[model samples]
Target: MKHRFFPAVAALLAFGAAHAAPCPRDAPLPSGFERWAHPGLGVAAWQESGTYQATLPLGRAVTLHLPDIGTVHFIVPPGGKGSHGPYGGMIGIDVPSGATYRVMLSGRAWIDMVQDRADLPSSAHQHGPDCTGIAKIVSFPLHAGWHVLQISGAPDPTITVMMSSTP
Candidate 1:
């Protein structure tokens, strides 16, 4: 039992050490994330409300509020429903045209795009560039219209988020 535990503990330490450190707040972002380098707008997330209380703009970073995961009434159940994080919330977005858009998050979290009362499927996923402060980026094919961006299972109460259309 002791030998087994030692290996497990060593593996956990190695995993933690392998994780990249977050970039400084004032540091310049990589080429694809240049717009996120500036200060972001602060917005409160809505809980238990279907109404869109805040709108996330394209190409701009917003400091979004993530209410307690237990309190939010998501449009649809998140894929990361089993997340151990205590925070999550929903926001609104207006897709100007039918295109592929990337949703970038400052930390690990689950993202769902909902339109017409249905959850849109993600097209692609990737990790942020080294030392860019970005943790994840998920892309979804969206059409022109109002859509809901549901963020769930976030470890923090607030996170920096940005959306941009693929050029």
Candidate 2:
């Protein structure tokens, strides 16, 4: 009986360890995410209810505050739908030059890039490095100009985001 119980105890312990809490908010980011180390910007979501526009700079992290999904006016319909909740928003990004850029998010959310009134499909998608605060990373080939980043179906009202040109 003791031997059999030991296996169960060990399995429970392993599961607990595997589900440890996310890294501290101030913890240093992984190598590719170092650009997010700087101070993060806090901005509200742009919704159809009002005339609001927010811009996020590349290579800097921003804490975006999203409104209810029903309130957001995405430039283009999001490719992915939100599951956790109705929290979603949009922010503008100015790409200095045409290049592949990576967008990092701290939580699960749908990301869509729009330019010239069209949706730009993601070029690649991957998970963040272990122990990094990032939960997902999506890459897109962008051109130099203004673009809209639509965030939808976030589980929470706020999410941390960072974008940087791939080296």
Candidate 3:
């Protein structure tokens, strides 16, 4: 009986190994995506539901640092230039009541802050066109608890998002 059980277990293992899926080594990387790093900020990103998701700690000094909005090339002969931003994504966060946070954006962006409560109006911020390629800092207050931040705009390889608490 013991010998019979051993054979059955071995056969199951072999079957699973044969059916295992192989990693997609030749698959192309997603467009508008780039590796990013920030010291002491505890930041990370992942793809979900056809969009990118990023999260970071919002300390007492809440500050969000985003990378620039894509790349720009310039020519000196006829004086020409062009650039395309990366795809946008969503960021989910929770803020304590009566806390204020500052967002440091690095390019043109449309930021929308919303909560589940229908009574609350969504907070929106935009910086671009007139202020392209420039780093802008905007500080705002939150009512606390969970909130979903929908950040849409040009994709940026070096965009940073930092949220720090206000004094």
Give the top-scoring candidate (lDDT).
1
Candidate 1 lDDT, 62-118, residue by residue in tens: 888677888787878887856678888888888999999999999988888999989
Residue-level lDDT tens digits of model 2 in 1-167 = 99999999999999999999876766776667776655466765565323235778778888877888887777787788435567888888878999999999989999988888899989999988777768899999999998888888888999999889997
- What's the lDDT for all of these models? 0.83, 0.81, 0.44
Candidate that would win on TM-score: 2
Residue 24 accuracy (lDDT) in model 3 = 62
lDDT by residue (tens digit), candidate 3, 1-167: 99999999999999999988754654442221111122243222222221123454564212243333222111111111232344334455667666666554555555545456222332334342221222544556677776545444545534455455544
TM-score of each: 0.80, 0.83, 0.44
Off by over 4 Å in 1: 1-27, 47-51
Give the range of the ten consecutive residues with the poorest summed lDDT in model 2.
Answer: 44-53
Error of 2 at 58 (Å): 0.9
Better of 1 and 2 by lDDT: 1
